[model samples]
Target: MKKIKNIRYPGKYGLLWVIALFCTGTIAFAQSGSDTTDTGMAEVSIELKYTEANNKTKILEAAVKTKVEGSWQGANGVAVQFYRNEAAPEQLLGTVTSDNNGVARMILPEGEEKNAGPEYTYIAAIKNNERFEDTEEEITVAESAFEMTLVEEDSVRQVHISLQTSDADGQEIPVGEVEVSLFVKRMFGLLPISDDPETTDENGEVMAEFPADLPGDTAGNLVIVARIEDHERFGNLEFSRKINWGIPLVIDPEKDKRQLWSSRANAPVYLIVMVNSMLVGIWGVILYIVFQTYKIVKLGRSKAAADTV
Candidate 1:
């Protein structure tokens, strides 16, 4: 019985013992690394969950987490510093204390770098202290932007929406294989015309048929819109064009109402006839006046010719 009790599970301490044994060789490796402080023991460690990405304004942010063994969760109230590593000049962005839930927030300011992609590298670190070991975590983020346009053809009755990148210059350089969504404008909301996004070709253009089934005003005026959303680089970009392709609108609730159109289409037959008769009478009087002037000029020319003879 005594031997069995001694051989049984060592509880939490037993798990730590096993982990220490497994990480014994690696602990020496961590000591040599700049990311680690010489820890008196291995039970307490810092973890960086610095990979969560958020882009607002010109900055990128990350979250840092720390923990100690035998504790239920995070090691609370730990002080941490955020850093941006370019090459020679490493900037200390700010210092934030770990919250009650044991999360420290960090930031990287102004997404510009000397590298080709201008990818920014950031580091979150817990400074050396008596209670816990110092630890560092690093992550990278890149800059991006987007551009879009819409085109229409009357002969073919087709709509072509093109997507490109204007990140470098204001010029429309073609970008291939990008997803684009198309929508047709409606009275209350936008009606989706394309079931799926059309991928751009080598020339950075996607063609989709404009929908003609929706109801519009009597003139059949409608607009087609294209949108790209939640893109990591450009965020949300949209463009729209007006076209006349929708069905003619009917304002009357009942059919066969003998209405040319809604209230605006109604006109009295007498009013129309009177307007046309007045226009014809005015034009006829003007024509008679022009004829009289021409006859007078001809007679004057004849008299001048006789006098010269």
Candidate 2:
């Protein structure tokens, strides 16, 4: 039989390998804090971003990003709530949950915060079964002016009423469907007129018509009122103008006649004629100066020659 080499026992080496693995696992568990009690949970970090498409109107949108450690991924079912402010009647905008990537989004409407101040403060809350967290942000609404234009034409009485609507920014509010009650009686107490209720246009404009037929309405003063929805009175988003539709009426066929002479009497024609005359006069003066200078030089040369003789 061949001499057998001394061999290390397989059982002994296997026992040593098992001990090394156990020590490595214990170190990892201690460092990572893998064990958790019912009260102890890892803290989650969340970030929020806010943006608005219309700054003038009270419309806002918010996006949230949540990040929890791999160990505490089970608590991601926490409900997220979006609130306007800390008041008792704080408006709840929206709510969402974290996705696998831990992101949530919420969009807030303008009407929700109608009663809110010109400047609005927003807050977001993230809550689990018991743990809760919140963050706050502030936004402002930009005030805007109203645009008014006369939509109808009346050459006879020279009476045209224009419509005006207010907007926070450029976004036009739907005024066409809005009921606008006209208070012509209250405005012009003496004037005799029928109903003056009118609807606004998509541009938030309403055409208030002044009838040509009025009961002895000879340049009489008039008043108008506008109301929308349940609002008792129309918001003063524009300046008011007083008007008397009737005036000194004159109908002259000669005055209405189209004449070339009358058309040329405009300021533009007069300006053009003045400019052409000035240019012609300037050129004539320049030519006259050049001719005079040439004559003087020629005469001086002739005199010098005669003197030399």
Candidate 3:
């Protein structure tokens, strides 16, 4: 009996100990789950770009996105701030709101980069956003530019593109062995003008013959674009010029005549005639059936009168 009592005492405590451990583990799991829920705030990303285009134009662009269901989606209407430097009392360039595609742009005035050194640092930031955590992106881009010239001689058109970088004294120095792209802007997107890629020679210049037969606007105006894209040293640089070098695209008035692709009010004459004729035929059949029924009823009444007589 003594041995059994001792065993029962330890057994009771052992069962209680097991129950205590289970409770502690459950509490820990619940705490961990709550932490996970608290971290459910959207994760946001920011992309910064520096572009130098025609007529010494420079612009800063930022793209904001958030993680949703394991996929990134644009976060529209987010306010993004641009700065020339990251150090505080930051040199604020401008503040802009993100558009439908979560892109924000700020155009820097001319000569804005005159004092900017050979290497420039640009920063874009989002602050105090409730739906997303504060985030910032920075890019350091080297100063570069493109010079483009158009020449037509003896009915042969050629475009000249030059890639140059700023020296220590801010003089234009040639950057050789770099690839450049030439394009013509269309209604939807840019179209490549050359079949082969154009690479700069030792003089930082590349020339390509332009297609003389390409269609342009009614005035024969073409917007030509030259670009150096995704360069590790220079980033993206673009230059554009407008010239009267293309064939005028004259539209035909016959295309506006009523056809299958025309609007409802401009439907084809044949389709309208066929539909009206079908409607008239169906109504005629219905009216003939009604008239026949009336005649049969009248004959039945006359027959009944004869039978009574």
Candidate 4:
């Protein structure tokens, strides 16, 4: 009864064929949606700008935008609003129309929706309308008061900028892998310290070596500025802090008289020559007039004595 049990091929290759077919079919099904027209995705974006009015009023301007197919045309006429994510119906900041560019802008009064802390993250949302599906986006902004620390030991001075951001509740959270820009303030303008921007590490910190040739105040004071310019998430923000990490102005009093750059030395050559020459000429004229007056007085006294004798 060992007569060729139906001559079936029980080889592993046959099983592999069946598994491959199953995987291919599954993948095809998963990606089949991309070819359909109903899989359109909508995007909502929010940008924030902070400004201080008279250093007392903290103003925040938020630009909300709705985009469709990588452009704002998809969400045209969509009713967009910007407000804090809160309970109930949520705070209704002024409703703005999405212009042809699909952007709606509004300014939140100072103290109304304070995003300075992590807990106060803002939200930009659009109501679902007949044209498109309802979509929303949340925004988190940290105070622009970025802090930097400088350390100099053994001629190896290192400057580090922290990359911690506040959550919706003003809670400190480490931000990973963000671009940072460093600049040194000079007499004319901000000078870029490095040609390439630096990125924050896992510890939410960006560090760079202090340039020795960087010029500072006459007393070696430097106003070093660290900035995060035009970030997709954080927008444009900067912080300038003063540090004494530069070469002070070098002035030699003997070989090189004090120029305008050196406070210990005299004024410029042209200014000294003009000023001293004027002073000497005026004193000479005064001394000549005084001598002539003394002689006249002496002659008058002698004539009076002779007349009396």
* Model 3 poorest 10 in a row by lDDT: 1-10
What is the model-wide C-alpha lDDT for candidate 4? 0.61
> Relative to the unseen true structure, what is the C-alpha lDDT of residue 194 in candidate 2, on a scale of 0 to 100?
38
TM-score of each: 0.35, 0.28, 0.74, 0.43
Per-model clash counts, in order, read: 0, 0, 0, 9
Reference-based lDDT, each prediction: 0.55, 0.44, 0.78, 0.61
Which residue pairs show backbone clashes in model 1?
none
Across residues 1-309, which tens digit of lDDT does each residue of candidate 2 receive? Answer: 111112122343555555654667766436534342222322344444443321223323333332233443433445556666641234676776655555555656656656443334555555443432233333332222233322335454322223333354534344444444443333235332336446556665555555654322334544432333222122222223344543323455675444544565443555677889999999999999999999999999999999999
Per-residue accuracy of model 3 over 6-69 as CA lDDT, tens digit each: 0012333555655664667867444322211123334577877778886487888888877654
User: In candidate 2, which residue ranges exceed 4 Å CA deviation?
Assistant: 1-39, 55-77, 87-90, 130-309
TM-score of 4: 0.43
Kindly indicate the candidate among 1 and 2 with the higher lDDT: 1
Clashes by residue pair, model 2: none
Tens digits of per-residue lDDT for model 1, 202-276: 987777766556777788877777766544444345666676777777776554333444253455556667888
